[model samples]
Target chain A: TTQEDPHWATPLSSFQGFEMIKILNDHPKNKSVFVHGKFRGHEEEAVVILEKTPFSEETLPFALSGETKLKVGLKNDIYGNYHGTPPAQVNGIKVSVVYPATPKHLVKYSQQQTYLVQETGDDYRNITLPFLQAEAFRIQWVYNILEHKQESERIVFEDPDKETGFILLPDMKWDLKQVNDLYLIAIVHKHGIKSLRDLTAEHLPLLHNILKKGQEAIQEKFSIPPCKLRIYLHYQPSYYHLHVHFTHLNFDAPGTGVERAHLLSDVIEHLEIMPDYYSKKTLAFCLRENDQLLAEFRKAGRVPQKSE
Target chain B: TTQEDPHWATPLSSFQGFEMIKILNDHPKNKSVFVHGKFRGHEEEAVVILEKTPFSEETLPFALSGETKLKVGLKNDIYGNYHGTPPAQVNGIKVSVVYPATPKHLVKYSQQQTYLVQETGDDYRNITLPFLQAEAFRIQWVYNILEHKQESERIVFEDPDKETGFILLPDMKWDLKQVNDLYLIAIVHKHGIKSLRDLTAEHLPLLHNILKKGQEAIQEKFSIPPCKLRIYLHYQPSYYHLHVHFTHLNFDAPGTGVERAHLLSDVIEHLEIMPDYYSKKTLAFCLRENDQLLAEFRKAGRVPQKSE
Candidate 1:
């Protein structure tokens, strides 16, 4: 749906109708899969005729509907074949194996049983199965397309396909749409500079160095550093996103109920858990975006402007 | 109520019976208008118990009766003295001009009606009669007591003619209770150390000086800083009561609706309304307590030699 339209109208096109599927047919690409779809049907003009109560009164419209399919096929290089890879025949997609969004064994099992579905083609050899439930899957796809830049030759389901409507494939291996806003609260040290200005000017790069050191320490100390800590430098409106987010992926596990809440508490504890001196020194590395922007202007071309 | 009481027994005594109250005759050293009462009820206990519930309980407990009215009271020096001076009848009677604990101005009003009642045996004289019609007036007494702690005295009602509660004299002033465990947050710049250990030094007088400075700053910053801020320095079986709390006093006015949700917001804004540098420095003063404590420890004190 286009946000500019009064009704936020969406357009519909077929699964085979998208452009990304053509790229999937080319075998040399290292990417694994691609999907695309489009959704249409909204009364934008009719909304203009009304008093705006029918549309503008609520954050989300009271009534809206659309249908789109996503076709996912592996790239030629992924399977070492010029054509599509042989489809993995499954009775129902095991959600845990595909999604793996949550950490709990029971939730993963339940999600596998509840959300997955096995779609059988006429020949059954080319059957398609999905990991997420119908509605959640659709929302995730739409959100992914909105976040990623448009490119014709990605592995994710891009553009249109025979089964789904107009949409784009996401570049990340995991779904970024389902993620909650992750925060890293760092306590600043190196006395006399409590304000944001002190942070970006002299502290953030120091923090980045500390964090890199800490990460290395963890590897050396534990002898098993994570393969994918999935740390990202995020910039947001309020926090200025100076902190680096750490998780399995960018996404936080949902449906963990008490576990998710506990995890949040534990993470807060861990961040503050550092020895007082180190904690303060490391936290100074994180800075708000506005402060970071100002610092960047002040330090332009001299050195990399670190977000405090 | 005792925490160990399995029956969840509530005290039979009305708030007037709390033992801490002092009769007007007992106070010869200081004289002013004041009254005090206590309700050692289980409201706080019940809340604590409920707050510590297990996450998967699936349901929350409904509050039983006798849970309300858990607050203490003091005499209202302002509205009760609305007539400028106390009536002759209030002599020696432990009388407190208490506004009901409910929302302020939740009482009814008459546009063009004024009535007078002769002062005889009635507790309060020449009250705005329209308040009787308002449902919320019944509980307005709580705010009155909390707001005017300085003007109220803790007096026990006594009568030779008929043994009963203490009497409230015309001239009495009261102070809030000074509990041994309570401590006020203090910020002092002269302390050479940076942490909690500095306060625990062998030089008690120096520690006292630091505390005095912090207290003075707190008073200079606010019109009426809380005299006692209870602290639980250590939380557990052998808990140390070393924490500091900033006392908060809220008064309800005409615009304060029955909800009173705006009280905290109003107080926060009021605190921030001070001159920018002063307010920031004051906030820093409060926040620096933890850092100051740590700083003290960093500069190790002289260790006493082992006994020969």
Candidate 2:
């Protein structure tokens, strides 16, 4: 019964109009005649082919001279569901078809028509996606520096919080003087957390310990008073790891601009008031033109595409 | 014996020349002729005047007409010493004259003639000298802030060693975050010691105390680590007061550039090695176009005057 089914006999639709007949008859010298139609709720105009032979009036739902075939392509499932790869998973994509000439609704339907579809999974990878991967690799390299114990000698102080292992070390490059011209960095041991985006109110105690322990160590080591010290974090950090920067108020290190630097105290206060503050907030930061993350955002419809 | 004084007679030659004659004869109506020439060992051109009628042919070694009179006005002493006030008590100056018409050798000599002299008190003051006075007033205002105890609440730390009383306070304007973004200014009680030039090995213990006490206070208050702190001083301070700056290394504050900032530890170490290190050093700093200090330096021959 499944073999004799009318749906299996031909790949074309049962609805036959004069345009369908004209298309079939006009292209007799050819094996197939392609007609435009919406298939399986996919409103994008699809090309359906009509075979010149195997015409049987007894089995056919429409009295046509030939059998029809739905040429929706191999990647599409039987129900005309598109399972092909997409540009990205985050946003919907628009598809269109331009018909040159068709007899059905000759004037009104002669132009172009478009449709939308939701993207998923690995479909999101694009040419710019490689850049995001490269950045991830860079962050990985910095993380490995700690794992290898290369900075063990440089560690000025450390807190024994196994969950958020905090450590302090002098920055490698210092433009300020060596005596009181001290520059230091504080970082967390949690590898899962990347930046402020991943931080929440629960991590407040760890941050507090880092700042407190760091201040104590700096006072003991460098002989700088608390009032003279400045501690803050960069919004778009140079590296993706969760870290804090401690510098002298007089040093004016790079990335201390209002747009980039976020004070640790303020961040703490903000979190105290609103637990998910950073997560809900829309952050603005400078990005190089070649940054693939920006391209991915553009492709996902999260940001507007740059003009040529 | 005073009547035979060679200095009082012509105000001319003990120094010989005819450019003196032309200077005396050119201003015919005036009884006094002011001609610039060197007197004493001082080489800067001094204003000298010659009188005509009192000229005894016996007193005058050279012949001159009865009509020739060149009497230069004087606020100077009989010994040719200037008593006018100077901007600062340092350096010597050079002066020159350009004559429009004279013989070829005299003309050539006139065009390039220049002499040097030590400036007397207040003799070097220009119209812009008022600015230097204003800056002194500004320093006095800051000093008064400490005296009146206006910053008592803001005084995070203080070390009383009588000779070098040290007090630390927050900088009024701060670009760094306040949590750890505290900017402290540590000033010496001895206001007479204006800059690093006044520092010597004798003040090392006082400086050491300031750093230590300030650090202890900061650690107790803000909980920032000593490794995270930075401390330094500016060479040509914004004001004429000896002060050290303590801040976080992350903050890129004004006057932190290599040309302006000097490390407190380096300064102390330098003093330990050489007591007069700062004073002996020829410090270079940028002066704004309108800075009165630059004008004073030019007048003192410490620096060359820029051509108009």
Candidate 3:
């Protein structure tokens, strides 16, 4: 079995006298090559041949905890299913090894992650998570570690990525998405400027010009009614950047909110993809989607009601 | 001193013995005019003179308790002293009406206020304070309320200036002025769109053109920057609106932070101001400010440290 698998590495002789042994590596499990017995002139070495196992939960001498963290080289053996049944004597023992997941959490590109902090200072060993995203990690006991008492002190983390890792601090912010048409509103939030005044004076004219020009450039394009869009500017107090959320609510349930939200998200995502060079079709689609979202919000009564 | 004031309206004398008095009117302090009387009749109104006393602690008797909110109105009495007094009484008890100083926790334009509601249903009475220029009446205990519930909810108060009352919620935001050179960098925790590729290729060119034109207009007219300038651009997960903050730090002291903050706040406040017609000076100021902020952020290491 060992010869058949060229990627296997030999095990250490320290396995002697152990009824159950477990071996873990940062690299993918497939590339690991295990050998037995000490090499020439080596006083300490293990003597055994590692064979591939068929089942994960049984048969293996040691049971795998499945708590292993990912690190470099973790991908090679990621496809294998081997359960380790380490002897009960290893129960309270702690073993530390660098894993691939450590660096991934430290610095990686993913929407699921908010921020990452690699170990810098000796005092705080664990990773740092912002108060907003920390809830996902199930670490509710972080409040116990604070010593100072100022309500205004901000925690700045050192981000190896962004020159300064401004530490993560807890903030109570209103989620605009929670209020009305989440997708329609979110698209507006993407544009930093708020208010129809800003939109007409700044975004609309430019956008119109771009769409008109881009429309001419593209082979297939559709006409759009500019006045059909109504924008309501909202200042997000939680976010540092002041942005305007465009609201184009239709009073009747002409469209479903779920579909509208998906369409809006897609349209905004498309807008973001090429903000400077938007095609006329893109503008037309966005206008069409926004019109639909407005209708949905109006039907849902999510928009604030005004007395005549 | 209370007898000679010409503004006093004599109280009715008919209801002299009545222990309970109730007056309902639209005016605040003048809503219901009542006087303690031993008799009950239309004639009792003569004894109830609305003699405005030298308002003081004696004029209003109430404790600043758990949920008792009052608006403190102060005026210069005959003695030239600022005498403060409660504007109204609820449940026959006078309460101190005061607006709290802006919270120390928030940087700029961020504060939380709580209105106590004695009842639940439609009968619930809640007086809301508007967020505007400093008024004589202020509310206390603002930030402490939002600290517990990490959500955004606001109490709307009627305003004569606008058709509807402004919605003021607890805003937890960062002020760009706090940083040196009036520049800010934010780490966007969204997936894909790494580097400046998304911004420059898609969003930047258009924005750059807008900003350039704005600066040119500013320079061509006022020959100076608009009063206090600010600029922002959205970047993702950590921040749904990733942005850069810029300010004119040249004219202010190195650490005063007040001017820079004002600059950013002003720009955000008036983002829609005459959007079509920005002066050359204003445009130049805004462009320079933006360039400075971006340069500062890069210098401060806002971008990824490792060059791929």
Candidate 4:
């Protein structure tokens, strides 16, 4: 009855009280009021509010039906103390907040949902649109990662001008199991370019520099002679990032086919003659059944829908 | 002077006399004559003839200075008996003819020469001229081989129409060590059809039939399901003879790249749509530094003269 007294409201844990406040705040039309009730499982009496409505004897049971007395008490008390600093201890006993454990199934379901969402987004970017549009999203993502230093651990060499760099990363399928069986992802840091198709005569100097510097670094780092190296790029890359692959010459890597792998030197020379050579040429590539780009190609009637 | 008597001339082994006669015959300008000489290291003497020239004691030493008496005797006797059958036994020693053993160095050199000749010829066929011209020689070689059944042991299937066939052979480098790790060379026995480029709508039915029958045969022979099979062909094949390669999909055999390998079904579909699609389209492929075709392309300004 003494509304001015700060102790008039029941003490509650911060978390529970905040949840109650959140529920009330979500219903903006309701005004604050007192509710008197016994929490569902306990003999202790407590007070709660739903807008300006007070809990009468008849409505008490419904108001405190599912939650335990301790839970209800904690919620209402926290809600009452919202505008003020909450007490560290309630009723002389140490007040602690414990979150309910999430079920294993729920945890797994949530994770799977997140993964599915990410995968679907990737599919949308990779398969639904033409290559140029698809490449925009890919280049943005790569630049974002580079800017954030997300791949710091993988960075092997970075040129002072930030125009070129290399990352020593392992391929999903290694052609060989030797210590030298590593893939050097040589990246031209210039943005917007998606693949060899985008390279032009303007990029020749940069390309030449990267190849020369990258080879030197590889030779020094791995103690492998230039003769032992094979550098090339795939037309239809696993992902749309302007990257050249450097592997041991003896390693018969997955995409090193003459049809698929354009030697870096050849690519540079090809650009030297025709700045838009790749853009004008009709390129061929392989696509797995599930590949989104393949579907896009099929939709455009560029390739047959039926696979062989 | 005792020329009429059969025993007047030394009873030489027919092979030795034939050798002497061959030497004289090779020098067509040298008429038939007789020569007498002591074998280089033997005490025996013999006579030989060259047109009408007669051998005398004074010239014996110089005439047979390099040969044994037995050799010279055999040559003269065989020559004298050219018009009539010579006795099988000579000097009571069965007239056994012994051939000098070939030198080890000479045998090795001859083998190397043969291999080099074959390699050079293959280079000429594959790289020197445009694909169409090069294919002419290739067709002729294939015809010769088929006529003579040069690779009979490798022939797995031969159609009665003589227009289609299969030869199972090992790839230069195998991706796997299994018994079924073999390359099925599917040949269209039509001499002028060099590759997919030469395929037209008229050839579609034959191409489709072969693909189906070939797959069935492969399944039956290897016990591998159709799912494991990958069939395709190279545009500018390592060699010009038109053939499709069939291998386990798991095997990443050389030349199975987008730039090179054209799926048989795709070829058929393409031909169906445009009878001369391949012929009209510009095909791209890689050539090593030593590839003769690359040089030709460079000379024609189709590609640059650079190796990567």
lDDT of 4 by residue, A1-308 (tens): 26773331322322112211111111111111222233233343332222212223342222212211111101110010001111111101111111221233223222110000111223334443355574454455466545645666656666645555444444445533463466667766666566776677887877888778887887676666554566778866766777788876544456775435766765775576558666545444445555566556567554444532
lDDT of 2 by residue, B215-265 (tens): 777767776544345677875577767888877654456665444566676
DockQ of each: 0.01, 0.01, 0.01, 0.01
Give lDDT tens digits, candidate 3, residues A7-41: 11232212223221122111111111122222244
Task: For candidate 2, write residues A100-160 as lDDT tens digits.
Answer: 2223323222222111111121322332235444655345445544664454656788775
The true-versus-predicted C-alpha distance at residue A102 of model 3, in Å, is 2.4
Q: For candidate 2, what is the DockQ-based docking class?
A: incorrect
- Clash statistics: count for each candidate: 73, 49, 99, 18
| lDDT by residue (tens digit), candidate 3, B1-308 | 16773221222112123332222111112211222222333332111111111112221122111122212122121101111111222111111100111222111112111111111111111111111112222222222222322222322111112211112221122111122122322222222322221232233333343344433443343232422223333211112222233322221221121101212222222223223211111110111112222233334443212221
Measured with DockQ on alpha carbons, how good is candidate 3?
0.01
By lDDT, the best candidate is 2
**Residue-by-residue lDDT tens digits, candidate 1, B42-103:** 22211000001111112101110111111111111110000011111111111112222122
* Model 1 misplaced regions, further than 4 Å: A1-199, A202-308, B1-308
Worst 10 residues of 4 chain A by lDDT: A73-82
Q: After superposition, how far is residue B187 of candidate 1 from its true place, in Å?
A: 13
Model 2 misplaced regions, further than 4 Å: A1-135, A175-180, A300-308, B1-308
True contacts kept of each: 0.00, 0.00, 0.00, 0.02
Minimum summed lDDT over a 10-residue window in model 2 chain B is located at B75-84
Global lDDT scores for all candidate models: 0.21, 0.47, 0.22, 0.44
Residue A178 CA displacement from its true place in model 4, Å: 4.6
The ten-residue window of minimal lDDT in model 4 chain B covers B88-97
